[model samples]
Target: MPFERVRLERVRLEPWKRRPELAALALLLGLLMMLHSHIPNIAGVGSLVESLLPWFGVYVPVLLAGALWRRSPSAVVALVLPVTVWLSLFGGLLTDKSHPGGDLTVVSHNVGAGNSDPSGTARQLALSGADLVALEELTDQARGTYEKGLAKAYPYHEVRGTVGLWSRLPLSDTRPVDVVQGDVGPLARTKPPESAAEAAAEVRALRTTVATEHGPLAVYVAHLGSVRVMPSQGFWTDSRDFGARALTKAVAAEPNQRMLLLGDLNGTTDDRAFHGLTSRLTSAQETAGNGFGFTWPAAFPIARIDQILVRGVRARSSWVLPETGSDHLPVGARVSW
Candidate 1:
């Protein structure tokens, strides 16, 4: 009878040994969790890996479910590493909350430039009832369309370069900020001529301040340079890294006590890229949101690239708005003094 029991135990463990894929996945999960902080600076590869980390939380559970289905003890134990890592990173998001908070309402959206239907996007954002709206990736051609579509609801608006801020409250002291795109001398000299016949368009970074009822709130709207993937290295997310650093320095220098930053940062708060902003401000979603709140490539949002960050304010509630024509989703948050 003892010999028979040993045989049964060995038989039960044999299946896990045969399924190498499960073991390999477990090993990969462990490595990712252990080395997450040491990820290389490769452009495309890095961004792709960083973007996929949040999804790992789901993958680990699915793998564990498969292990249970197969009755593999080895696989079941292997899942614990990733399960612990994922839960440690995002466990708090699972808790139930009655509501977030009550002072201010803010929204952020990328509003893809190639969007076939700007009017639809505008309508969706306007209906969100956000007190302030920040939009990025605004092209010259589509600017008027958005302005016209949003004018009725957001009476006060400001546009600096490619980014714009529209507010129901009066906006004042708006100005463009130099975000270290390139040589300042050449960029300044290349400006368009005063006369139409000799005019030539020039590139410049976008920034602005909005005067809100809460007080003079300095709002910064930015669309950082995109990171791309390549075969040689892995992924390239450096442009965003540099842009984030520059934006951070600028924000630090600003004298305003109440500040709000909204943008398609192209990275999550977990990423070190936003350390400058994250360290100083409270993420609205983190404080008051209910779910993962992913908001990129509308076909399937795997990450939350768009964000609403605040300093010297309180967040009451936050949520992702319904999708519109743009490839990105809109994120909104309500805050109080």
Candidate 2:
């Protein structure tokens, strides 16, 4: 009966019924990644999924390993679905797209308010060799330090609210764009700052135009409302999402065609919340960086919340700068007119 036993083992290994559960899971993962936007945002599930979507490809290999262990031919073949979907979505990010030089080099950083050494951070930024540097979360105590520290490198600078732009070039039409979506959501109960300066210090977005040899390049520096996970509320993103929508309106009214948006947007281009902004601007990191340029929780970054997006400008190269004292790393990009 050795021949019969061999036939049974072969049949079990080759049949679609073997490891059917694994096959189904493979299909599910493929569809989930492909149609993540339609997953619905109840409890911020959709945002969470899309924010970490690129990492979902990790499951494909796990499933493949399981299939191999089980010796299920059907399961191994089914893994192809998720693999293809994953490569289609994130394969482009695997290669280096950065070019050698460009007309402008801009760097954006959140510069955590809780950063212990603002002066050190400023010094690092000044020596970073950027034509323009945009900073967010400028506390009252650190503002002067940054202005002084970045002065030698960047002769011209402008600060509107907590957002500021320090540039080697001239700046004009400087103003703050309010991104507060009323007093609702997670920040509804947040206490107001002590004085007018403090209140202004609390503001998180600004718009300014830079005088370039080619033309006027409008630059926006923003730090959208923060997000968090709550046991009771699931993935809490009300504040961040509201801020994104408000920022979208301001961008929609922008007059300049050549524009550069730099900041810790508090969300990635992968997240659907930035759809309006992404539709208008191209992410420098996504277009030119070698890999996923994650810039958050500086110690070990997993998501790319900081961004340098441009319109009517070619992003020749993109990269992440060395760690500063802040919680988020700096993102730099070279753009040409």
User: Mind giving the per-residue lDDT tens digits that candidate 2 earns over 174-290?
Assistant: 988877637466557377667987668667898999999999999999999888888888998888888899888988889898999999888889899999999999999889899
User: Each model's C-alpha lDDT?
Assistant: 0.76, 0.90
**TM-score for each predicted model, relative to the true structure:** 0.83, 0.93
Worst 10 residues of 2 by lDDT: 180-189
Top candidate by lDDT: 2
lDDT of 1 by residue, 88-181 (tens): 8778777643274576788989899888998888888888888888898888889899999999999999877678888988877777665534
